[model samples]
Target chain A: MAEERQQGHKWTMIVDLDKCTGCQACVVACHAENNVPSPSEDEIIRGRANHWIRIERYWEGEYPNVKARFLPVFCQQCGNAPCEPVCPVYASYHSVEENLNVQVYNRCVGTRYCGNNCPYRVRIFNFWAPHFDPPLEQQLNPDVTVRGPGVMEKCTFCIQRIRRAREQANVEGRPLEDGEVQPACVQSCPTDALIFGDKWDENSRVAKMIPHERQFKLLEHLGTEPAVYYLKGGETHVGE
Target chain B: MRRLASLSLRQRLILGVAVVGAGALLVALLAIVIAQTSAADEQPLAFSHKTHAQNGIQCQFCHTGVAKGPVAGIPSVEKCMGCHTYIATDSPEIQKLQGYWERQEPIPWKRVNIQPSYVYFNHSSHVAAGVSCGSCHGAVAEMTVAKPVVEMNMGFCLDCHAEQENKDALWDCTVCHR
Candidate 1:
């Protein structure tokens, strides 16, 4: 289902589930780079935890030969996002240039409509004030905002890094080259399970990888065209 | 409902008046805070931009980082001594500069323009876009003690950003808020 992409860049990500070790380097990298709030151990179960990208673990089969399947779920940057139209405040909108779904922090009034309408359940509400303990507070990334309570936030695909890379490319009087802008997750992947690039460019890796037999979009039947593409693992049922 | 019923009309009136009065007081105090945040905070040495600018000294001469980075960095004491060594040795300001240089200390220059903690401003990007210092700071060459002549508010920034000629693709909230 290849279609013509929008001008400038159509950003996309490809995650090979087969190669994922689930070491969660991407998780730690995202936390460090994006200033995800650190809720205390007790607050975590109370629905006050914050994670822009979360690894969903689904256990398969009984305990004898059980296996945990990990799915790293974040905002899909959907082409027809359910979250967008539901936002009465117009805080959640799409960025055409990068094919990104961005949240306007100041404009968001914490209505939680966008969160409710999201099918992927990627949107996490700030149930309480975001915090970082003593020394961790000093480690907050200056490039990313420590979003206040009463705002619903999700993964922006590291918009700060994208803007910076674009600025540099513009200053140099050249188009952004392939593999130029790596999101925090893509950069930290030890197994190179994740790849990010402008799908508009024919030569880009993501564009080339899109049509592979193993490639699939999460909830494709729902018709929400996600920027993220995942590859199925080669494993089969234990008795099969 | 029961709690309100327990109070007489006079008591309610007094409470209403107090709420409005407190609200107004709070608003007034916020205005003062905002005013002083951008107020031409008195620098330690009372450096005059008017005199230096009139003498054909560029804004970049002292604020070297303006064109290349996030901050328009303040001039080091050594930079002042670089010219004050020969130019104005007898002047009081020059003597002050000399003293800081001898002490090997940096001059803690008060900022004329202030950005809130939430705002992420890039000086290099603005400079590259051909924006003049006066566009935001007002006429730097004309000011004696440089204060924030322009109100650096979100609306102020968005107006410039959404302009037809200056319309950048980066009107995204994360562009500035982060």
Candidate 2:
């Protein structure tokens, strides 16, 4: 039981929104790393674009007191994931080893039940075979698959790269270093706003960030126990 | 004999034609294989690697990003003129390099060693681990047309990695998979 519990390490991320300049580096990095297809303009207008990590814009109040907030959202990989229970084919389930919500593309029949159940609307469906134009396709990271049509897809937290890093560490007979493994989003963030690590590790950065007063999860009222948390933005700047 | 003679002449002709077509197809397939093997020997350019390497140009100069990224990129024509602009302006090969640069079209260098898209090999990691370029590329500095001498099969990669001297870099499926 102890070994099983140890194996089920919860991986989490805390994005400090205050530090985020809305540069979209994380968005581009995620796309490059995971091979997320860029949808046509028509599809984007219909909100069918597949962005694994998106910077959501929120507006509050009127002209004099107008305040804009940006939040980077992605697959929360919830402990009690709502998407998991709704998956009729068991395509979406939490992995026993990493506590990651693994989405098996081969198994997904595109029923989209999981997408509907997700309150955050992070899951993206491939209406067409995702393709990149010639030279652009060459730039794709071979680690991840380019999903075909009729399959539901979402973030896997770059599990393929993680698996690679872990295997390398094992070969060397040493524990994984702190910054040895970084997802594309975390790696590309210019301001270091996104911090990813093993949440189960008491000394991990994620574990330390989660307890801060400014940290909170989206739709936490539903008891989803999301692995992702956001640090609230700093005080608004006004004409002095 | 009377019953055999009752068979339609057209039906007998059709059977004879089908057998002849099958025979012709088999012969054509063998010829194609022989042609391909012979065609593989043709070289488009007879560039020498030994002379360039001897001039103190590192392998990474022509194969840019080999030490920093996933791809060991074929250097653009502009990169060639960085030194050749002053060193060998009169040479025919240098003139060819300059002409391609003026046109802004890259040289379509033939890939002697190509891996399938599924395999994720990072030159940076391998180079950092002290694996020489010759280990997989087969003494590129000695070749003229960069012919692939080593067959980069899974077994070959495993065997090299399993060497006691290279035990630290030994086989991991994810190393190449991801």
**Which candidate number maximizes TM-score?**
1
Model 1 misses residue A15 by how many Å?
A: 0.9
lDDT of all predictions, in order shown? 0.82, 0.77
User: Model 2: per-residue lDDT, tens digit, A61-136?
Assistant: 8999997778988999888898999898887866766677878775689999999999889999988888887777
lDDT of 1 at B177: 58
> What's the residue-level lDDT of A194 in candidate 1?
93
Can you list each candidate's DockQ?
0.42, 0.10
lDDT for A82 (candidate 2): 89
Segments of candidate 1 deviating more than 4 angstroms: A61-64, A236-240, B1-38, B102-104, B163-178
lDDT of 1 by residue, A1-240 (tens): 667655557889998887777888998899899889766778778865677888888788997989878888889999889999989888898776667888877678999999899889988888777778879999998877778889889998898898778776765568889999999999999989899998888899998887877878999889889989988874742222
lDDT by residue (B48-139, candidate 2, tens digit) is 78889988888987888776666788767777778778977888877877787788878766666767554567776677677899889888
Instruction: Indicate the worst ten consecutive residues by lDDT in candidate 2 chain A.
Output: A1-10
